[model samples]
Target: MAIRVQLTERQAAAREEYESFTRQAVAPHADAWDRAERLPEEFLEEFAARGLLGAAVPAGYGGAELDPITFGLLNEELGRGCSSVRSLVTVHGMASYAVARWGGDRQREHWLPRFATGGAIGAFALTEPGAGSDVKALRTTARRTDDGFRLTGQKRWITFGQRADVYLLFARLDGREAAFLVPRDAPGLTVRPVTGMLGTKASMLAELSLVDCLVAPEALLGRPGFGLAAVAASALELGRYSVAWGCVGLAQACLDASLDHADRRETFGVRLRDHQLVQRMIADMATGTAAARLLCQQAGWLRQDRSTESLHATWLAKYHASRTAFRSASDAVQVHGAQGCGDGHPVQRYLRDAKVMEIIEGSTELQQTTIAESAYHSRTRTTPTERVTA
Candidate 1:
């Protein structure tokens, strides 16, 4: 087991700090929050005040201004504690990053500060009732009005939708897709809460109905046609990276829980770990977690370099890490046996959340297609000299 990469001392320290805080504050309440189907506003406010929620915000905006790896570290720790909290941060980053990268001056000045300080919570609205995993099929309409734009459409599966103060929404305007910043208070917009979700129960997911919702002309995030290809893609790139790291955290959590259960629980007059089958499962969980972490680290560094190859790297990381989480969580439940199946057990929640991870930020099936296509093109582009046999 040679080391392929190493974290700097500063990075290690930062990760430890985040882990410590999450263990004390967030992890203890994850299951309870999930059962309640809501996350406390005060908890999110505290997170924002600590600058954990504003990883993408710059120093000028009164934020922590963390780098990609550090940002990933923050997300990882949060996921380890509670994925619902992590999802909130991920969705908020999508909205905040969009504004920072493409928003007009006024949009930036108004939104970034609020986003950093938690004066406003943000959510991304791209998944519509008929159009998820495929943004081109979106039917949301953006009609031009003299005073502003009139948006009419329904968005579904919006995380933090019930509580988000603003949404980074998308609509088709004259055959061109565009992005907009629609405040929660916008007239003709209605929010319908979605409960009984299989995972991330505290995420406050909701459906949004916009019936001729009017917004200022400045609401457009970028010029016409920049919605999917530019702004949404940019935000989703960060999202994939964040999700990849978060999955690593979830897998690790599963591994830790499984190990503890196996060590203490005795069956057939022996500890669970004494069984060969149980040992094999633990081995798989441990190795899978390590692989996921390695992939996430690779993705994080590529993101830091702003490399074109980073896109596929992120997809690869996300695909692998999410599966790792699902598998590990399943094994954790098996190790815990009856205890794991019981309500209020963290492993049960972990399994459910891990399944959800496989679907979001691009499903496992979608990533496979995209990665395969990228690999084919990459092999064709590489010089023969660059290929070496092991």
Candidate 2:
């Protein structure tokens, strides 16, 4: 489906450029990357050279400084080709944005250029064995030392962890959350790859072990006691936007595949597209795709404008789009019959990828709880004057 919202000429041009690049350079390699279970280093170099790797970083820091909505559009186009590639953008952008927003001038001057140029890869280390969604429950700790801090903990499910040059690692400092920029070469640091993920094989996932790793005072990002909140505020908004767009892309792909299969496949006497049930399924897919795209775009716009409802809108978009993607992909597979189950067919891959979208970043159940809580609080809250009067 075509985008319906108004776009600035520059945004339109950027989208066109991104779409062309993805179709030519990214889409053709998706199947091979999936089969290999690794993102090609060449792809990274190419992305950097094209300024796609750090498109959202500020211009002074060697980035394109594109607005968040444009970044979201770029992500959607890339996701249409390969979700794994889009995952790279999500993690990298999140790390860079976190530093830019909270890092000291010295930190920004030292790190932003390398990060934007792809001379350094950044990974956020937050998830742990004992703590997935509960930030306060994290066990990683950093103790004060003579000139710095000593960190010790295990971080799990870190994207790009194995090869990242720097890490935005989160740990507790004096009973408060803090973020540190831990170099990959930091002494006593170890990274182990995790395998068998259902999708996004091209993006590496690793477990990190920090055994008394030392970080200088300069390594700390922002003020102490704000790491968890900062990361959550930034990552959630960006993650929700990226994944919601991704789900729209997945739904569109499913709809296209299902339509192609239905139009060509023949039954006992006629083509599958001629059947009433097949038509109904295609109609459902199209409707879902349109709805998902609209919701995603609305969220993106709200985020770009920094609207008061941005948080709730983002959660709503992500929750609905992910469910729509999964349902559409499943229907696409059914439309393809046995061929959809084969490794050679793309529909099966879409199905697998769509299922992964439902679980990663934040689960559907989590989104539901967030939305409900937000709505509940919004309904019950009163102004200070109202409370006093009551």
Candidate 3:
């Protein structure tokens, strides 16, 4: 946690500001929000007005347009306070990034301003009941029609779906994968709220049903067959980067909580921190948090460089950071003993939300494979002689 990522004075100031905001606006309410399973409508508006919801869009669109490192700081601090609030930032940025990169003029013009100005909340609707990590296996279909396309399918596990004003939905269009911008009020679209999750219960999750939903031709993002390879690929890459930083924040939070509890609690006439067992957990939590933060910063550097290697770096960061966050949360609960599992305890909530971090953006197992596969591919790109010379 002592390791700091190099930042400009402005960025450093921004990070401090984010920290102050989180301490004031998020930390105190996090547990209650989790129990309630929904954030107040006013909070969303304030979040958007503060430019957090549109952190990735261009300034012309009324967004803050933060760089990757700066954006990571924002996510990290917010994640430290409450992952459900951080979830909104991640998904909204993903959707904004997609439109900025892949959307046609009309699509961008129609959506980016609203998204950037807090006039709309955006969600990515790529996951299906059977296609959690398999983007290509989505069952949603968009049949080409005289006017535009007829969309019919279901999207499950959509974060902020219950309140999203727009969705960047993926479907098979004329037998090839495509992306479409579907407004919430589109004809034949239904949103069903989902609750009682293992974690992130306050994320406002929902299942979207598009029964013959219709969008004009302008709704299409890129050309047919480019959905998964380009739009979704780009979005998910940024997503991994954001989630990795968020996990770093979560880990740090757990470590801080554990440290405070050990200092304040005693057993058998000795402070908890005086016990070797508690000290060991604290040491592990601190080390893991530092390592995860470093990895996330490395990925952020690659992202800012616009390097091709950024994607794999993100895989590595996400894989390690998520595991560290979960492990840290588990130890935090252990340090608190029975009290940690009860109501009004933040550690209990952290434990649950950390589990969701390991699952979303990409599961821990999924990231391991992606990193290994990418490593082999990079190695194979060099000839045998070049490899040996290297």
Candidate 4:
């Protein structure tokens, strides 16, 4: 079945340009980056040169002003080349989007142009050692001062943490959640690099500690009590959109790898493609990919339309696509047999990368719970007249 999302000519061109950039730049460096476990500085500049970074930011802020769906398309293409590159897209785009949407004039003037040009790397610091899914469990605190706020807390598993020039740091202010912009050179701030990630090797995951990190009043994002809600809504929207598209790319990669291996490998004097089980795997992969892609695109369209159902659709897309990507990557690895487990193979990387997708942004179990709770609330909140008399 053909995918039915309508793409404007401009969007189509953007996608093609993204694909071309990935093929020429990111794809060629995947192995080297994985081996080094560091993203090359030059690559970031290349992304900026291509106008790929901060593509979703408004034109007034020096961005392309593209919609989220277009950004997703770009992410999918980048993921097809390398998951790390896709992750960079997610983190940068998400942080920039948050700033653009909720940031005040000063915040916009300070970060937007730098982000669009890749001059400033932004990281979202929300996940703490003690708090994963529960935002209320966050222990990071900020005390209001005469001049500004003094922040103290630790943020772990922060993507681009070590390399971020500025952090969108979330902390508790007077027992309420608040977010502040902390520069890397801020006093009493430290970032330590974390290792041993299954995928996204090039991304510099780190743990950040802030001991009386002073932030000016102008550094606050949105309102004091609304930080958690604002960040949650923004992050989940971007996470789901990016992950959904990344899953589609992963599925496509898996399909291509499996097909290639099956066509070349022989079993009992026949190609592996001739086997019924092999064909079934390919069919399943294709079906799952199509379903996930459609859900993702639908969510994106809803977001563009400013529909209330966008959040529900976003959760659905993330949950479904993460599962699909994991399954497809695992199956692809199985299809490749011993060769798949070998170091430096794209399938192995895909398998690792796919697993991380399930955990980041929000876990699969978390999304499932969100979906179920949403359904339950919807049913309970229905008007008596609207309720069926079964």
User: Which one is best on TM-score?
Assistant: 1
Kindly provide the TM-score of model 1 when superposed on the true structure, using C-alpha atoms. 0.97
Cα lDDT of model 4 overall? 0.85
TM-score, cand. 3: 0.96
lDDT digits (tens) for residues 43-76 of candidate 3: 8878877878779888887788998889999999
Ranking by lDDT: 1, 3, 4, 2
| Residue 326, candidate 1: C-alpha displacement in angstroms | 0.4
2 or 4: which has the higher lDDT? 4
Deviation in angstroms for 32 in model 3? 1.2
lDDT value, residue 157 of candidate 3 = 87
Measured over all alpha carbons after superposition, the RMSD of each candidate to the real structure, in angstroms, is: 1.8, 4.0, 2.5, 2.7
What does candidate 4's lDDT look like per residue over 277-345, in tens digits?
A: 989988888899889888888888888888888888888888898899899999999889999999998
Instruction: Residues 69-118, candidate 2: write the lDDT tens digits.
Output: 78877887887788888878877877788878888899899888988899
TM of each candidate vs. truth: 0.97, 0.92, 0.96, 0.94
Write down the worst ten-residue block by lDDT for model 4.
1-10
Q: How much is the lDDT of residue 251 in candidate 2?
A: 83
lDDT for 86 (candidate 2): 82
